[model samples]
Target: MISAGQASAWPKFAHILGHDEWIDMPEFQRVEDRVKNRVLLDPMIAEETSKFEKNVLLERLAEAKIAAAPVMTVADVANDPHFRDERSMYTEVTHPQLGPVRITNQAVKMSETNPYVRGCAPLLGEHNDEVYQSLGFTPEEISAWREKGVI
Candidate 1:
């Protein structure tokens, strides 16, 4: 993968990336199959575990800054270099049961007030009691609501 900083300094990276090997999908022929069901069958059955059409090396697209890293899943975002660095977009929060947990930091910046993640994303019925308490429901009432499947 080409690092962002390197390619940002050189515009030639864009020209090179446009002509890379995996840019276009490999040619394939589709067959019409009908018996029990009608479906298009792929004659180009994949021998490689990886498929060319869906599995381009995102890390090799140097000019596009977003493509500098290997493909990251949703769960991988927290650990990605740009997200998890010293100056991070994610922060550590101590959840009551989950212990130290990661959560996304707020995107807004303000001088008068600030935005931040307060705790772990709540589990089912986790913050129900707290919300009920704020709404002036007693603990007993909150418990009754839980039993009644109100939350």
Candidate 2:
């Protein structure tokens, strides 16, 4: 496949990615095949089997002018300083059953009105009563609906 133009490289990649073109893009397939076969595939796999450091892989990719990052699992963020630090992309909220739990912080950063987590995810049926009441249901009616398994 032909190489993309040099200007605003990331935006083009983002545009293609946003359009979900990676699966169908011939360029992506070509690059994947090359990386998996011709280039440093065997050495990279060997390095992974032994040392297997994400940072090392990232550095190698950076050297090759490839922008990439290791796929991080949910547990990975808990131990990572970038996620758990004070200025992290994570925020803590109190869960009724689980106590304090960390979740994604507001993605949109605003200087004047910073966003925050109000509370952790609710437990099953936790908001049923409140929701029913808000919809003009009386406690008796809610209890009747609950008895009928409608909620």
Candidate 3:
């Protein structure tokens, strides 16, 4: 997302000049350079940079007067003209535990059926008994393993 400073500066300049002032900002040039460096020049730079390093880079970019777009939400995606035809992008599923859950179908649109969740996440060691039984272990053997801190 664009920094608060960039958002503030652009609007203020635009208001004063009665037109977009971002066209003349050196910060804009820095932003273009940063994007070009990250995306066009070396896309892998993003993977190389850690979260902390990325934040630091962004801070440096802000200091150099670069701007960015704000983060978009699901509503924004649904309303966007480019994605409007992809209405199946948003779908609802019946989760066994959570009841009706909204899931994104952005992956495969050809399938008309909504995805279904089998169940909630398993609790730690909840299936120990069942799994051990499936492996042909008797109740006594399972109890012995648990007592010996092996299970």
Candidate 4:
């Protein structure tokens, strides 16, 4: 989310970010050019982020008033009160093979219909007969294919 407007602030926080090369990087004329520079930027940012503990880096960013958020893991998201309790952004379901699994809920709410994950994803080829039948294939043909190992 860096922008041309943040150009001034970059130099101030460059020491905290562990890189002075940001000031030397070329000005980007287009989105593609900025994206192309990720080869140089990504490693630098990753290196800098690794030097500090997560909370320490976050505190530094907060002190600098940087608009940044931690990239949370699934367990972290599940435990966060805002996402789990307030927003109800996740739900748990029983996976046939994996047992209980926590899955994300629909972000968008609809007035007329309630969208939700009814079950875990189907196993491979679980709906083969139903799919082929809908496509005008008969039970006999589908069963024959299964018998002949064509499916």
Best by lDDT: 4
User: In lDDT terms, how accurate is model 4?
Assistant: 0.73
Q: How do the residues 1-151 of candidate 2 rate in per-residue lDDT, one tens digit apiece?
A: 1122233332343243243343244443454443455344344334432453567655654554555666788789667786667556787788777788778877666889987777777788788889988999899998887799887
Q: Compared with the true structure, what per-residue lDDT tens digits does model 3 show for residues 62-133?
A: 664656443468798777665555455555666656687665555544567755444445667889899989
In model 3, what lDDT does residue 107 have?
Answer: 54
Query: Could you tell me how far off, in angstroms, the CA of residue 94 lies in candidate 1 after the best superposition?
Result: 1.4
**Best of the two (1, 2) by TM-score:** 2
TM-score-wise, the better of 3 and 4 is 4
Report residue 41 deviation for candidate 2 (angstroms): 8.6
The lDDT for every candidate, in the order shown, is 0.50, 0.58, 0.54, 0.73
The 10 consecutive residues of candidate 1 with the worst lDDT sum are 28-37
Candidate 4 residue runs with Cα over 4 Å from true position: 1-5, 14-51, 109-114
Where model 3 places Cα greater than 4 Å from the true spot, the runs are 1-19, 25-112
- TM agreement with the true structure for every prediction: 0.39, 0.53, 0.36, 0.61
- For residues 66-109, what per-residue lDDT tens digits would candidate 4 score against the true structure? 76678888889889999888777888899888999988888777
The total number of steric clashes, by the backbone 3 Å criterion, in model 2 comes to 0
